[model samples]
Target: MSNSEITTHDPTSISRKSKKKKWSKPKKIWVSVLVVFLLFLGGAGTYAGFLYSKFDQTLNKISGSNGKTANAAFIPVATEPITILLMGIDARGDGETLNSDVIMPFTLNPITKSATLVSVPRDMEITFDGHSRKSNYVFPHYYIVDKEHAFPKTKEFWSNKLGIPIDYMVTVDFQGFREAIDVLGGIDVNVKMDMCYQDSTDGTNINLKAGQQHLDGAATLDYVRYRKSNCGTKESTDYDRNLRQQEVLDQLFSKLKSFDMVTKVTDILNVVGDNLETDISPDNLKQLILSYMNIDRGKINFIGLNGEWVSPFMVIPDEEWENAKRALKIERMRTAANPNPTIDPKTRLGTDMKSNYRSSGNNASSDSNSSKSQSSNKNTDASSKSKEKSSTGSGSKATPTPRSTNNLKSNSKSNSNQGSSGVEADDRVPKVD
Candidate 1:
């Protein structure tokens, strides 16, 4: 049962008058928040330093799987890519079981000004410390096991899964997402159909009419978060929900360009800061803004792992899961450094797996060097073959990307900024009876 279920008394029969009264306060709060967003845009450089000092206080540092500090994993070079894991958590202020409703490994290449954003389905299963569960719990479970070094353990599993290094991570709370959107005076989007749903237990009351219209923060939440629709025609399907999330993101950023962002930057920062936790330093944020801020919207790549699109939970294919990792630049194309002659060097995704894995399966960072030494005879022999890419002509470079028959789309034109406006944060009510 959801935490809301435990709290709300007779949710279905709750007063409609109360929900209407609730709307008045959020509108006022969002207006104030929107003013801050513009102020933030108007003078980012001037305030970046001051904000950095305060933002530094929010850092939740943890060592990487390779034993390097999270900050140490960054590669500022224009050519080399950097990866960031984005977590969208669904938990109100109360002490509910916090699950990652969304997980996206976002990659950026500074030189090419490109991005590869892979949204890992929350229902996809992943192995963590010999225990397999849905990937969404990877962090929350670790946070419970060892809060101080939770990220390290979680990062290790993903690192092995992807075959690439993750530089940083940012977690966004759902409430903050609502606040941010509401403050921006809601977002304008085209609605494909009428959406009406309510859940007393989860405190979700989503009811929006069909067609193009401006959605307030409350309506905006329903616009993106509603995966089940009463209007039928697969309105509530996961695939369509993902598309809606991306659409809201694209529209939100598109609207930012016309705003006068010089009134209240600090306030907006405060509103958002409280809801986020990340290891990315303030300096790095500034560096990204100055160097990689003007990212080409067209170049942003959306990645989805191939899986059995089972309702609510997707049984993702193994190699396709690995392919999603490579899209994040975790699994790199094999160079001469690889000793595993069985795998082809040009193959993408999980091509040249890992080198430092040992037979005992203890890839502990403390004994990383030793693990590599004992694995000299690892993997299948040279007889194993890998899938190869075909080119139209000779002298053409084979793209190292693995085969993925999944959804892929990029953001539309927008204001130049360092942040990836791909993922819309998540929070869902129980299925309406």
Candidate 2:
């Protein structure tokens, strides 16, 4: 054979060429896959880092510029009990005085994974700064007087009233509340009654039918804030408002614990950063989330302190006040002893509101007697009305005594005309008359 033909038919060279071709194709494929995978990993890492940075920044903003790392009197530790005061500020109007109409003292026991929420009435009379005014006005009064020490003053006021350390304070404006709910795609609320109210001042027009329905931000606000209805519906008392607030909050908590919230964290953080203010440190806040993210909703007790409507003030009866204190104390003791404790729901300390405010109209009927007892109590002196004995007692069943005829007559007239203006008057500002 000729040399060229021999070279072409060489078995060794042919085998080598075939081997090279076979290896090169597979190698290119694997290299391409590896390059793509590395790019993906790098991109993921960058996104994660970005989220982390955003989270940190948002937390810092929520914590405010108080230069406080943790509570001065109480530091949140793992598996311990902590109390936080949540204040919902009513900032419906621009440059309007801020009033914390919704005041709830929340206690969380990490050991037992139980929580206690106590709602304070907005119109509850309290003495602060050498004057007697509604509790809701305290924050706004301080905010206008001493802007720098507003929160601190407010926290001190509530801590003394609740007789708890109150480790942290979280204040969220109405705008923030609305935005957060909207970001969560609204919430599910059982509307208790047909609500219809309108206000041209704040652009508020609330019309909601009673039913198991889905409420958006505006509707939810209207639901919680339906004090006086212009459409002949029954006016809502502070107690009713408190119950609605608790209901909305319970639903909100459930949504927060959902898997869907993971994707919406950034949006929530953005809203919170803009409108929410808290003294909780970023680290402890993160720790709280990690610890109680899966807390049982059934273990949470919602306690609303109801009392007789004495004009602008809702004077809590001695028995109801003491029962609330006992319930809160017992919750702390039970959780400290055991993670899960069997407690009766009728004791006012339980998760169910068997002894809720509305069902105990007898307590309201004895307003005169309760008021007398409250006035006589050494703790209820002019010097200090917030400090009372932490005594436990059964609800009072005293016979209904006649209230002041003049006061009742005047209050009745006021109630009938409360909705005439289409907006509830701010009690913080004194009338010019």
Candidate 3:
């Protein structure tokens, strides 16, 4: 058989293709302790850094069976890799551009590292034109300054303000957030108390038991946002709720790892994709999968912004936020210190792909190299041909393209930012859940 014919022979190829097209298929697997997402104060300390490392490894193992391809892996065909900037907006009643509660930019370096999640506090006070305003309110200046390009505009403003880069954006409204969690059969969270609180803007009356329980949309809303009221009864502060949100994310991630979770993810994505806007395309996702396939779960990293809030300028104040801006810019770009000292890159899969890419690209085009390439091609062709023959005799499709190594990222967006605003030092929730 000719090289092309021989390469078409493997049944493994068909199986692989089937698997790829059905990448989102539901599985029977169930992993409950998803750790990456933790409430900023509670769960964040434990999961953020380590969980991402493990998740990367998991992806690598999954992609190993599919042999790596050189040209088609992750390098975008038409453009540079995309960086998705996701925001969780908290818009209250009758609010428009001025109300973005949660502002975090998730940067995916489509080449080697997995997606980077960077969280910015809503209370950050920024100086736009001449007046000062909450960081959440800075979206208006971003939108106004560059009306034609939402993602770039928002990213540029935040990146410049925070001294980082904001590439693409995906902003979700409140309704989308609620629906996503609910569709995932209500995430499992560990609440510390039978909390009760009322929010006048969203008209939320939240009450839940303290302990490990499954939380529906409504309960999660209350659990995540519940801060003690001013009378010193309820905990209130972005610091307090950060970890809670992370916990919800951890649970959701764990759930997404399951086969049933696959169905839910598809459902959620379909339901809210339009609500979520982003510069990352399906191609970007494919590349991420390729790189993520090699990262070891233990090598993933996370960095926390360590700063106190200070009052100086506006509704929120600029001093504390200014300090935070200075402290957090590097961490936002995933250049933060590797919290786990023992985390090794060689052990992870994503890092391997990056290393491989470097090594492969460094080669010269020579006669010896050409011969070796031919030999490798021959072996691959033989394997594929064998599979193809089996499949055809058994009444099946042709050989399939293997699933390449790629990183994975699960995202959600908030609608608006309207609730309380102010700054205080050590604002992070003090305990881990």
User: Against the unseen true structure, what C-alpha lDDT does each candidate score?
Assistant: 0.48, 0.54, 0.41
Q: List the residue pairs that clash in candidate 2.
A: none
How well does each candidate superpose onto the true structure, as a TM-score? 0.61, 0.64, 0.52
**Lowest summed lDDT window (length 10), candidate 2:** 7-16
For 105-136, candidate 2 gives per-residue lDDT tens digits of: 87777677677888988886454432334668
**Residue 268 displacement in candidate 3 (angstroms):** 1.9
Off by over 4 Å in 3: 1-83, 95-98, 110-112, 140-147, 228-232, 293-299, 309-433
Question: How would the candidate models be sorted by lDDT, starting from the highest?
Answer: 2, 1, 3
Q: For each candidate, C-alpha RMSD in Å?
A: 14.6, 21.1, 21.6
Q: Judging by lDDT against the true structure, name the best candidate.
A: 2
lDDT of candidate 3 over 1-433, digit per residue (tens): 2223211111001111111121221110001111122111122323334444544454344334332222211335122323345676554444333345567655443233444454555654343332234456555444334334434445544543443444445565555567777887887767776677666765667767678898887687778767544333445456556667666665665565554544343365443432333343333333444444434323323323333333321122233334344333323334334421232222221111111111111132211122343343344346546766888899975432211212111100110111122222222221111
lDDT of 1 at 59: 29
- Candidate 3 root-mean-square deviation in Å: 21.6
Clash totals for all candidate models = 8, 0, 75
User: Where is model 2 more than 4 Å wrong at Cα?
Assistant: 1-74, 129-131, 335-426, 430-433
TM-score of 1: 0.61
